[model samples]
Target chain A: MTNNILYSIKDLSKSFSQSNKKVTALRNVTLDINRGDFISIQGPTGGGKSTLLQMLGGLEKPTSGMISLDQDDLEKLGEAKLTNVRAKKVGFIFQNYNLIPTLTALENVQIALVPLGIKKLESERRALAALESVALSDRANHFPSELSGGQQQRVAIARALVKNPEVILADEPTGNLDEETRDQIIDLLVNLNKESGITIMLVTHDSNVAKRANKNLHISNGVVTTRS
Target chain B: MFFTYLRREISKRKRQTLLVSVALGTSIGLIIVVNAASAGIGDAQKTVLSGLYGIGTDISVTKSIQPTQGGRGFNFGPENADSSGASTLNQTRLTVPIFSGTFDGQTLKQIKSTKGVSRIAATLKLNQIIFKGSIAGTASNPTTPQDPNARPRGFGGGNFNIDMTSIEGVDTSLTNVGPLSGVNIDKGRIFQASDANSQNVLADSTYALAQKIDVGSTVSVGSGTFTVVGIVSSASSSPETSANLYIPLAQAQTLSSNPDLVTNIYVAADSSSNTDSVQKAIEALLPDSTVSSQADLAKNLSGSLSSASSLVNALSKWLSIFVLLVAFLIAILFTSSGVTRRIREFGTLKAIGWKTNRIVRQIMGESLVTSFFGAIIGLAIGVVGIFVVNTIAPTLSASVVSPGRFGGAAPGGPGGPGVPGFQPPAGGFTGRGTGFGRAAENATTLKLHIGMNVSTLILGVLIAILGGLIAGAYGSWKASRLSPAVALRSVA
Candidate 1:
């Protein structure tokens, strides 16, 4: 049962110092994620949903708590080791579709493997296959600016997938898209999690998108409440 | 992957990179050219001085003529003097023959025995008047007459109107050595040691033309008519590049009615580097004599040329450091601005697990590439600038000219026995001194040699690379410090 748990979080807390004032974003949150679990975290604005995703990605340190991802405690790992974990064990998708504008879609995806030091030919092959999984192979050569919002987010998803990580941390990944494009992105992510058995954790403001996940965690005013 | 990414990034920001590189190149180019010219002038200065002072001769020792008790007032030139010579026009107006200082055979022997003294030659210079053939209508040479005739109100003896000429008696054996080594025979041969006792003469081309005298023609000199054997052009000619007549040392002494005395002695050292020490030693040896060295000649140079050389040397010394500093700062500022604009990009790279040191290296590579291009451009500009400068500037440049203590003279003139012209022919006109015998004056103009040498070229490259690194260090630091979290943060 312990080996099956992908993430085990206990008494997690986070705060920010803004203009000489401390504002708590997360308070005393305890959660557990099993392998192959597709979890969506929803909350009102400034309620630590995105902050929790950031922690899962090893992008930020928690003020206090224990976050164990696949038996490795993120808090205990040094920056270099944490980066290694991020690079090899987890991937990220962002609300703004953070694709390097200077690179084509294929290159944007290929960059995810840069730290792995793959040869260019092998990296491009993996990038193309990842883009194909997102149904974006036809748009592989297009830059982010040349792509529509939905297509850009799909490219970002491809970038996250190309690393073949065990889990994906997405923060409002479809928030910037139109209604139709948003639903299409949801179906694509659901298909990825169901078919690949990769654990997916996302922060979304939309309840409809939350309902599609296997598990949902709701937070309000820095405190968490569970929903099945 | 970094290089691929970097190349695209550079292309994207081509305008900014080009602007920075061009600015750096211009500064580097200036430093290169100015330093090269400075070094060139230094070399040219030495070459010019050696040519003027006498190549192979380390130290010059000349006796200064002083007035005696009995010898008196102005009996400037002979009543029947050579009216053909015009050299006196550019010389000190007081052209009267007087009692001159002399260094004897014993002194010459003593000097030759002195340690560190290599080879020695003696010369005697005299002022004489020729009363015969007038060298009136000759084609004028294209050299300038620097000194103008500003005849004094009451100068020279009354009722005497004869042409005054300058005559030099040289050790014909050593004419091909020292400064005389540069004297070329435009038409005929120069005098040789074997001709010392012969009545042969080498006439200055300009003087020969002025007097309508040709080589191998009989010409009246002093009290003798010697056969003309050679025609030569010399730097020591009276007005400047013109040739003065030359006769064998023995013949000159016999004609002047003087013997056994030479007014100046030139000593050659083993090498030019030893000139300063040899000069000091000679100064100590001939305390009453005037000792001139190549360094002395350089210091006495005057005019715009002196200022130009001094200004170039100063500029080369300090301007490079200042300009290169400014260039370094500009590169830093430019790179820093690029870093500011790419904060998100840097953040994203770090977020993707790219290490801080890797980012730093990427930035450094960009700077090194740009700096390499800048150095090449700078070298091109410098080479072109050197050619341009060399093309416009005149050849033979000298800044400080001390006509009083340092001037040109023939390698040989006999200071032997005295036969005063016409004696004043009073008291048999016991020839006394007028303090004008050996004028403390010389003229040397050097042609400018301007180009880049290996040292200056190496210096330019070093500055370019160092400037790039200095600027890159800051950009890399800023890049390395960018937190990966910035990419995840809200745009707000």
Candidate 2:
């Protein structure tokens, strides 16, 4: 682990019980993610790409070995501390644009700041700024149902970037969009990464998305391999 | 932000919100209506009792007349023949009520000394009978020798008329606790201290109106002509007063030939709670007499009022409770289901770093807002129910068997005039048949008026909140159990 490394992973493994059988999603995986790294993971469905991204986001716990973010062991932290790590250090974007249906696009973005204990007015201001960065400020008050797929995905990206987390974990962020909308979303995410220096770990099945990342990794049957 | 989110969420799911609110609201409304009806029945009971025992009377003591006690006797004789040889007779007798037996004034003293007795008044309840007719000249022939075994020819020959009036001997000095306390003077004045031993009389409004009697008119009773000094009516809604005529106790005792004796003793306790003890004490002193507290007297109340009281106390109360419990269960189930449906939403929030407590808070906030709206709807429904009850104004009739009147022995023998040749005068007395000593049992009718009080309204609100809390708690518990990984997996 170097001084520039934001995440240090060592021989981590994760398994799930499926119909009383142990199915491993990640096995003896070793990885290092440095600050400002744009890492893309590519694999088939159920091949541990989303599992690895969830682990890096602190949304899942590894069954063995150790993983750390900024010197704090993810496996050793209590529930409250783990939640705090997730709240202020990591953000997530789902493939389906998981914005709350009841709230406007701006409020969906502001929700990320809720767990950080920010005041409502300050949260709204920062949310607006995040939406502007994503070029979705014009649709800030539009509900998720009222927005196009690209616009909704942009709102989801704004929500992830609003907290200024050190890393954003996006699982197939453009998986559900058409080519034009997918290109627009990918451009927005790339711009956020280039300007803000935010680390991004994206899991995608599309080789085009993987080619844009600074580092590309492939996994199959719970095994990881870096692409040249 | 919290409130805005809550509002949006509630508005988005209108059907679910309405379901919970209407269930809870109907339950709360039923509770309010039932409680109000119970209060109204209580007031009606007070009115009925006031008609029977007067306003402040808490305990009443009386003795039932025995079969061997006595019977009414009338005597008519001829000093000679009036011109055509017919005997003219006119007689009026004031006697104690067939159901009541007199006790000396010493009993009143004993009751006054009883523990918790605050005020005591004694009264003599009497019945005045008037007979007016003349025997035929041929019916009572003095010169003719009558065979001892011969059947009389004039057995159905008399042209006599009879009338009976209910009267009360009131202790004017203690009107605060007796039957007189329940009357209002319609004309003239009530008795004064100086009128205690005087020959003044008060006529009940109904009786006076029927007889065309007014203030300063004269009415005959017990061989004496009394000037009607006042016209009085019952203070309650009952059409009939406690008695047809009110007379001074001294004059009643002298005229009825039962000196220093009273048939009924009315006692007012120091407080309502002490009435039982006072009744017990009086019962101990007068073991053979009937001593009744207000509650015991209420048992004697029959008719629509009593039925309403029973329905309000038993049926309505239980129904309200049953409906409230069902409402709470429905609310809890609905809220839990709503949370279950939003599992993916909650999982996403948890992944975004929202604490379990915050998610729980949001669920509870939604449930509570629904319940608050439910409370408002319930209040409106309850007010409407109360208004309907008042507008209907159902008249409930209540009859209390005057003490010693029920299941008692007949006072007199077979009905017949004292004269030899006067049969039962066509059809006994004018007003009533002399059947088995049945005393006049009067009924009081009152209009029921439901009322709303502050405490009941507060209770309705509190009940709605409680229902909300219970449902919210269950929903929150379910939401808290959803681990983000598992919740998201289920939705995925």
Candidate 3:
């Protein structure tokens, strides 16, 4: 591991009991990603790709593992500090484009910056800049319903980028878009990754989408095999 | 930033927010009005008491006796005898023996020198023999001729009427006679020290009316001719007794044709002095006569009225509590439901690294804002209700709602529009029946006295805020416990 390692996971495991039987989502997974790495995680459905992503994002604590971001242990930080780390260091883009309905595109992005204790006017400026980065600056004042599916996805990406986090995680960000919109979003995300030098970790089932990443890790039966 | 979140949340759920605010406002407004009305009743009671007795007296004493067919004899045994009579009493009577002995100058000097004794004024109780006209001649009187048209009368062989009278001799030094002293003189001048020699007297209005006499008219009582100098009104004196002529005590004594006989002794003591000591000293000096204090009389009167008023006040207070409690509970339930519906939104914020405390603060802030508006609306309604009630029943003495009455206005100015400078009648508290009757006539006036004070308003808002906080905190806590993976998957 180099000093540029942004996140490392070792022996990370998570299981759920269904009807008195254990179902393991992830088992003994070991992975490390350096800064500015754009990695795509590909696996069959229910193959623990989402679970592995959640643990890496510090949104979920692993059952047994040593997970560290930079030099800080994810399990050792208290709830408040954990929240701070998540807000300042990681940005997530979801498949549903979970934009707050009541807020406009700008406000949705601004929500990510609220936990950072930024002032309203400054947060709005930064959020607008982030929206422009995704070429949706004209839709900054539109609500999620007013925008098209592709435009909403762009807004979600803008919300993620507004925080300027070290890593950006996308859990099926383009899963709901049509093929053309999906290709457009992949181009936008890749361009963002290259321009900002932000680490990108995405879980995708589309073969064409997976090929755009700098690296691919294929997962099966709770195991990951890195492919150069 | 917190306010922004609060404002956004409230505006986002406009309908729910309105429902909660309206419910809370109406409840609080009603409480203010009801409380004001109740307080008015309490004030009325105090006024009635103070008017009937002096402020120094908080209790009353009256003789308790069982009803008996025959006349009861006096018991002159021990000084502290337990009369052991039934609680039902026809009336209380203070009896003093009449002694017709020349008080040698030395005896008068001795009385003046007595300890614990204040100044005393002598009084003469006179019984009048009234005759309508000349009596008809009886058969036993041979020289007396009877008119054939005149019917023979039963008993004493004449149309005779008996009238009871008492001459209260007030000394110039002995002023301040409780309710009697409070009598408003309608006309003429009160009895002055010099008037004692001029045969001038202050007569009760009722007595003057019955006698068909006005001020400056001379009326004969016993052997004295008294010119009415003033007419006075009194609520305490009975209708029958108020008809008697009030002559100077010295004149009554002289007119009795026996200046040495004094029926009763009236004394005035310093209001701040220990009445018990003064009473004991008087008892020692006037061993043959009975001594009584005004405090003993007031206590007996106050005790009876208070017992009944207490029960009514307690019932009204409890009713107010019940209404407020139900209102608060409804508010809590509504707030809880509102918070539950917004759980997903809270979870989103939590997942985005917003602290649980921040979420809680947002919820509380929303509730506080809503309740603040509700309280304002409620106060407006209460004030309007009070004004309407006051208008319909002006006699209810809507003074209770006046500023500075009943703990001042309700935070703002709920008491302003009624009657300016109006004060609830001095004797406001009457029996429940009386109080209700007045309230029915003018509820606004009644409520003005009972309206909520600043403290009550603050307490109400605090309770509302607490409800909001609890609901919000519960929602946030539930959101926090969710695994981000599960939440995100659920969204998908």
Candidate 4:
């Protein structure tokens, strides 16, 4: 994989107003992630890890500082263009595995390709391939309810991968899974990153999970410290 | 792609969507049905009233006399003559004859030539005794014989027997008084100008039949027995109480015991003629008698039917508003609940890069499809309901249901032969086969002059689409505003 910087964040800060009081979530933090790098963000609860990820994913704008992806400043893009960028370039995996309960595992993956205006048959084929990549091909027809917690999270990961985006942002990918299932999910994500050379930024508090990344980012008191 | 999203969204919230659609369809359908029925009945009533009373007659007049002056009161007799023996004695006495002076033929000619007199007709009213019992006397009364020529006394004073009359008149063009004088001959014939000097007379069918008299049979009126040349139906002048015996003016005068007096006079004018001028001319010609046109007479006879029709329209409008409100509330509730239940699914779509606008379009499309189906179902229900109501409740005519004529046929009773019926061919609640049937039938030949217009259909469709759009837009906006992080957190 190329050793080119894909995301560069500098002096990023964010604060929210709650009950007429200002509560800072993230304070001056700087980071750089290269293409194909798998980085894990580790911090205690309320450590601003999720807030930092949201800002980098363009899901929320930083209160201050600059976030650039592939030399394109995200702050400069209009709302519509920002949304378009997120749709085309970023894939998100939530902690809850947010697989739409009404859809099957394959359909959850198929949804990612819909925004690309792919034909139904091709989209389904791509979704099937994504499910197969996660080793859930046999369970493609099962709905989220029919799958275990680990299986649902795997389906969510497949949905994220089907988009072929430039960055994969996962917020506590195995936060709700048992240790055994969590280990399995981490292994699958690590192998995916190694094989596809896809850049992954994951938020996790587990040391074992963090150890799987090529680089570790620690956030404390709104400051991010990168340790190789 | 958007439609696929819509299908998914609907499937996700099937119950909520269905509830909203059903509520909207029912409300809108109810409004449509009520409005259609009210409009239909209003038009029918207008046609019936117009047919019964010509156009633009603002007033009506009848003989008014002081009850204490011993003057003859206005005749308010039943539509059919007395069929029982005790009713004739109760008939109000006519002490002041309709006409008391000598019958002057020169005066009739003079009245004919007067200006402002569009058309004039002279009428006579009298009571003639008729034999109603069987020709053969009952076993208890051997004195009476079974013979057509047998003369019986005191028959006119009995309830089962009474004096019937033949009113005669020439075809005079009176200003706006055509309905009062325009006798619709349903079966046989009408009095002609040629019959003026002849002995032929046209009697009311109901009266003739009740009196056991047939056409071509000779019946005595005054001093003469005239052959029943024709049978005329009753005019719609008084729906409940009008039994007219029509004959030529001259024949009527000759048959009356008092030949010089005429019962009443009616004047009809051309559409362009001023009613006031005709009234003035008649007043000047006959200073001692009353002079009034059809308009003046109608005002005194019955209240305006238009006011009643307006009341019905107002009621229908209120009903429509109520239905619309109900539909709006239902849509709001169902859409809100639907959006709430689908939060997590929406977040997933958002994560997969679905724009808010695309999501909105999908919701709207689903709502529109559901609303369209519901509207169709509601329309079907309304049409069938109206047909069933109309069929079962024959008393509720296509015309305004007047409180006074609740149990009987309407005045003018389904427009006589050659006259159109009250229900117009084009107006009424039309849907399913009803509207199309009417269109197909009316295409070949014109029957009822009124019909359904494009505005009705357009209005219904527009309201339905508007409902769908509103529901869909509301659902979409709600879903779009959801926080993907919070939604994902909530998903178990």
TM-score of chain B of each: 0.65, 0.81, 0.53, 0.49
- Model 2 lDDT tens row, A161-185: 9999999999899999998888888
Candidate 4 residue spans exceeding 4 A from truth: A1-3, B32-51, B54-185, B189-203, B210-315, B387-391, B394-464, B482-492
Instruction: Please tell me which predicted candidate would have the highest TM-score against the true structure.
Output: 2
Best by lDDT: 2
Better of 1 and 4 by DockQ: 1
List per-prediction Cα lDDT, in the order shown. 0.71, 0.83, 0.61, 0.61
**Per-residue lDDT tens digits of candidate 1, residues A96-131?**
887888888999999899989999999999999999
The local lDDT score (0 to 100) that residue B66 gets in candidate 1 is 40
Residue ranges of candidate 3 with Cα displaced over 4 Å:
A17-23, A218-221, A225-228, B47-51, B54-57, B62-159, B162-177, B180-185, B188-208, B211-319, B394-490
> Each candidate's DockQ score against the native complex?
0.49, 0.60, 0.49, 0.32
In order, the candidates keep a fraction of the true contacts of: 0.55, 0.70, 0.47, 0.49
Per-residue CA lDDT of model 3 for A1-228, tens digit only, reads 478999888887887787999988888888888999999999999898888888877877877878899888986777778888888888888887887777788888888998999999999899999999999999888888899999999998998899899898998988999999999999998998899899999999998999999999988888888987
Candidate with the larger TM-score of 2 and 4: 2
lDDT of 3 at B192: 64
All-Cα superposition RMSD per candidate = 9.6, 4.8, 14.3, 14.1
Q: What share of the true interface contacts does candidate 3 keep?
A: 0.47
| Winner of 2 and 4 under lDDT | 2
Pick the winner on lDDT between candidates 3 and 4.
4
The full ranking of all candidates by DockQ, starting with the best, is 2, 3, 1, 4
* lDDT of residue B62 for candidate 1: 73
The number of clashing residue pairs in each candidate reads: 35, 0, 26, 29
